[model samples]
Target: MSILIFSLILLVGAYAAGLLGSLTGLGGGVVVIPLLTLVFHVDIRYAIGAALLASIANSSGAATAYIKEGITNVRLGMFLEIATTAGAVGGALIAVFTPVNTIAILFGLVLIFSALMTIRKKNEHAEQTGSKWSYVLKLNSTYPTANGEVAYKLKNIGGGFSIMLLAGVLSGLLGIGSGALKVLAMDGAMRIPFKVSTTTSNFMIGVTAAASAVVYLQRGYIDPGIAFPVVLGVLGGAFTGARLLTIMNPRTLRIIFCIAISFVALEMIYNGFNHQF
Candidate 1:
C-alpha cells in the first residue's frame, strides 16, 4: 500500500513537471526539484540526482520536435556543450566533497535569486543585440515563429560560455536541471531570441545532465524506486504541456512561472536554514 501510494505521488509530480516545463520552457527540474524536496521530504542530494535524470528524459523527449521544426540551433548547442559539460563534471566532483548543509543553503539562495530575477523582468519581444563573441563565433540563427521566420544574431559568446561554466557547476553541485541559467546565459548574455535560446538550451541540457549523472550513479544516488515514477510522470506532463503551449498565453505562463519560482525559492531557503539531514 505504501509503495503504491508513493508511486502515485511520483507519477503526479512528474506529470505536473512535464506539463509546466513544456508550457514555460523552463524544463522539468524547476518543478521536480521542489516537489521532491518539499513535498516528498526527500533529501536535497537525492532530489537533485532524480531531477537530473528527469531533465535528460524531458530534453530527449521534447528536443526532437524542436529540432525537426528547425527551431533549435544544433551548431550553437554543440559549441556551448563544450563549456556546460565540462562545468557539470566539475560541479559534480565538488558535490561529492561538499557538506550537505552548505549545499542546501547555497542551493536555496540561488533558487531565490533566480526567482527574483524572473519576476523583475518585463517581457520584451524585441530581438536583443549580439556581442562581439557572437559575431566571432557566428552563433546567429533563425527560427519559424507565428508571424514568419525570424533571424537573430548571437551576442557575448564569451560571457555566455563563462556563465554556462558556472551554470554547469551549479547544476552539478545542486542537482538542478540548470535550464534557467543556461537560457539566461544564452538569451540574456548572448542576446539570442527567447525561442532560439530555449530550443538551444534544451538541446544542451541532456549533455549537461549526462555529464553529472554517471557520477551520481556511482555514488548510489540513482535509486530506481524513486526515479522510475518520477521520470514517467514528468515525461507525461511534459507532453501535455507541449500540446497546451499552442493554446496558452505567454504572459499568463510567465506570471504563473514567477509565482511558482518564488515559492520554490522561499521553500528552499527556509528548509536550508531549518531542516536537518
Candidate 2:
C-alpha cells in the first residue's frame, strides 16, 4: 500500500478498535494487534508498541467522561495499580526474550475467553456485604443510577489482585490494554457493578499501559510514524464512545465485541500455528 492509503487504513481500523473497546470496556489493543499483524502484516513488536500507545490514548480519553459520571472508583483503581504496575514491569522485561508465536497463541486464547466473558450477564446488584479487606481498604462504594446511587461491595481482594497481576502481565507482554481481564477481576472476582467495573477498568488501563509503554519505548519498539495515526484515531473514537455510553445499551456492544473477538482469536491462532503472522 502507498503511504497515504496505508495511513488511512490504519486510521479507520484504529477508530473501529477504539470505539468497540471503549464501548465494551475491552480496550482497543485487543483489536489493534490482530488488525496490525493479520491484516497489515506488521511485525508483532511494533504492532504491540502502537497498540499500547493507542490504548493509553483510548483509556485516557474515555475515562474523563466515566469519571465525571461517577462510575469510576478512583480509590479502587489506585489500589489495584500497585499490583498491575509491578506485573507490567516484569512482563515487559520477559517480552524481550519470548517467541512471537507463543505470544500470538496466548493472545488468541485470551481473546476467546474475553469474548465469552463479555456476553455473559453480569450481576450488578449483588449483595453489599463487604469483606474484611473491602472494609479496610474501602473497596465498597456506590455509583449513581437512574433510581439512585446503587451501593456495592468487594468480595475477594486477594483474588482480584492476583488476577490484576495477570492482566498487567498480558498488557505488558502483548502491548495491549488487557481491560477485559481487569473488568473480569472487578466484576467477577470482587462483584463490583458492571458499569463501575468497566469505567474503573478504563480509568486504570491508562496508567497500566503507560507504565509498560515506557519499557517498550526504551527497547525501541515504538515508532512515531505508526503511532501517530493509531493514537489519533483511537483517541477520537474513545471520546465518541464515552459520549454515547449513557444512551447505548451495553448488551448490544457486547454482542458486537463477541463477534469481533471471535474472529480475531481464530485468526491469531491460525497465524501462530502456521507462522503466517
Candidate 3:
C-alpha cells in the first residue's frame, strides 16, 4: 500500500481503538495491535511498537479528564506503577527473543479472561475495608458521586500487587497497556471501585508503556510512519471517549468491554493457532 493509504487506514482503526480503550480502560494498543497485524498484514513486532505508541496517547488523552474529575486515584496508580514498571522492563527484554505465535496466543487468552471477568455484578458499591497495607500506604481514596464524594477502600493489597506485576509483564511483551488486567487487579482483587480502577488504569498505562517503549525503540521495533498516525488518531478518539465516560452507565461500559474484547480475542486466537501471527 502507498504510505498515505496505509496511514489513513491506521488512523481510522486507531481512532476506534482509542474510543473503546478510553471507555473501558483497555488502552488503544489492544485494538491497534490486532488491526495492524491481522488486518493490515504488518509484522507483529512493528505492530507492537505502533500499539504501544497508540496506548500511550490513549492514556494521556483520557487521563487528563479523569484526573480533572477526581475520579482517578493518582496515589494508588503511582504506588502500583512501581511493580508494573519493574516488570515491564523485564518483559520487554524477553519480548526481544520470544516467538510471535506464543505472544499472540498469550494475548488472546488474556483478553478472553478479562472479558469473562466483566460478567460479574456491580462492583462500584461493593463493601470493602481498607487493608492494613492500604492504611499504611494511604492508597484509599474517594470519587465523585451524584450525591457527593463517596469513600472506597482497598483489600488484598498483596494479591493486587502480584497481579500488577503480571499486568506489567504482559504490557511489555505484547505492547498493550495491560489495562484489562490492571482493572481486574484493582476492581476485583483489591475491591477498588470500578470507576476508580478504570480511571487509575488510564493514569498508569502511559507510564507502563513508556517504560517498555524504550526497549522497543532500542530493538528498532518502533516505525515512525505507523506510530505517528496511530498516536494521532488515538489521542483524538480518547479525548472524545473521555467526555462520554463520566455520564456512561457502568453496566453499559462492561458490556462494551466484554463484547469488544471477546470478538478480538477469538479472532486473534484463531489466527495465532493457524500460524498467522
* TM per prediction: 0.89, 0.93, 0.91
Measured on C-alpha atoms, candidate 2 has an lDDT of 0.85
Q: Score candidate 1 by TM-score against the native.
A: 0.89
Candidate 2 Cα deviation (angstroms), residue 106: 0.9
Instruction: Choose 2 or 3, whichever is better by lDDT.
Output: 2
lDDT of 3 by residue, 4-100 (tens): 9989988888888778766665566787787888788899999899888887777786666678889998889999999999989989999978889
Candidate 1 lDDT over 1-277, as tens digits, reads 4998998978887898777766766677767877887788888778887888988988888888888889898888999898888999999998979877677778767766565544445323535576666667777777887888887777667888899999889888887767778888876787776778777888888888999998999998888888898888888898888787777666676668867776776767776677563
Error of 1 at 183 (Å): 1.4
Poorest 10 consecutive residues by lDDT, candidate 1: 117-126
Q: Best TM-score goes to which candidate? A: 2
> Residue 94 deviation, candidate 1, in Å?
0.4
The CA lDDT at 155 in model 2 is 92
Superposed Cα deviation of residue 8, candidate 2 (Å): 2.1
Q: What's the lDDT of the predicted structure labeled candidate 1?
A: 0.79
Lowest summed-lDDT stretch of 10 residues in model 3?
118-127
Model 3: how far residue 191 lies from native, Å: 1.2
Report the C-alpha lDDT of model 2 over 1-277, residue by residue, as the tens digit: 7989999999998888878876766667777888888888989999999999988887776676677888889999999999888889889999989999889988899888878877788866745698999989987888999998888888999999999999999889988778789988998888888889888888888899899999999999998878988888887777777678768778776787788789879889988988775
